[model samples]
Target: MKIRCLIIDDETLAHDVIESYIKEFPLIELVRKCNNAIEALEALQQEGNIQLLFLDIKMPGLSGINLLKSLPKAPDIIFTTAYPQHAVEGFELNAVDYLLKPFSFERFLLAVNKVRHKIELESRSAAAQGYFTVKADKRIHKLNFEDVTYMNSIGDYLKIFLKNGKVIITGETLKSIEESLPSNLFLRIHKSYIVAVSSILYIEGNQLVIAGASLPIGLKYKDQVIDRFA
Candidate 1:
């Protein structure tokens, strides 16, 4: 399956270079080349979903990093930036790969391969079994998809709270877990949380009354969350 992509950057030359690189592979379809996140968000709203984003860390008003956090359904991101210091934060934001600025086309291909492998593994895993795997203590533990109520992100860790009050905390991004979970059952409510709709008691302001806790609903995700329950 092809990965649909979007390039969000303010530089015209950067957009051209990225577009040229994307054309080298037939598996990628360029949906938009947005000059800013506002334009990108407009495009996303108009066109529906995109699978990946080649985003620049430093941009005009809304930086690429902040853009990811503001999105309702955060897509796979590969941070293409000049600053090496941002690498740690980029990975923390769950970027699939980090491409340092002035990177070659060859290196760009490498990053895409990483994303491709992840997609294939997810597709195969979903097709083969109904269980989701969590890595803990050097081993992968598979949990049935239906047992999870909601997943929370605390700093660099993720906690999976099940229906029976059992939980497992692991160091995986909420994005990866969001991808691994059955899409029909899990909904993204904030930058740091994904909830099973059935587990929600109700919505209070931006918070989800979920399992005796109030989870803040992300600003970008608020409308969809309300629509889902309305």
Candidate 2:
């Protein structure tokens, strides 16, 4: 499967450099080259199914960050810019990687390789049914199905507790994470909590004990929770 790429930069030289570098990797196919954000948007709509974007930050009209913000569903981005300050903002947007100007082909290959690995993992994950990947601490964290004891919602993040006394704090939402896990092996026993079916030690009134920790079973969820045990 080729990684269809789009180059959006005000500099023709930057486009040329990227195009030349990408030629070394036969798996990458250049889809289109656009001058500005608007052109990029147009190309995206017209081209459709672009998997990778090489976006430039300082263009004539809209900035790369702003352009990335505007897309409802964006492709994997590798920010190719002269400015180093926007690197933080780019990562916050979940870009695959950031490349400063005058970057080597080795560096370029490194970023694209990350995207390739990510794509392959996603494909494999969809087919296999054992673990799920979560992004945390500026890296991808893989959580095995049997290891996770429970998950608790902490503000905008989740505190995932494992059976081995490890806790992973991540930005993944409870609802989203719940949907990702196998329904047969996990249960949402509360609005803010999800527990592994095999981890529950016993039910104690409105709460269930799992791995020596007490987790509440919401009033609304009690019936279904009891039915699961029944």
lDDT of 2 by residue, 54-79 (tens): 99999998999999999877889999
Positional deviation of 95 in candidate 1, in angstroms?
Answer: 0.3
Q: Tens digits of per-residue lDDT for model 1 on 1-230? A: 35768998888888888899998976676878999888878876654336799999888999988898898777789888888988998999899999987889999999999988877776666746778889966878888767878888899998989888989889887766766664446677777788887788988887899777889998756766776677
lDDT for each candidate structure:
0.80, 0.85
List candidate 2 segments past 4 Å from native: 129-230
lDDT assessment of candidate 1:
0.80
When summed lDDT is taken over every stretch of 10 residues in candidate 2, the lowest stretch is 119-128
Poorest stretch of ten by lDDT in candidate 1: 177-186
Clashing pairs in 1: 206-217
Which stretches in model 1 have alpha-carbon errors above 4 Å? 129-230
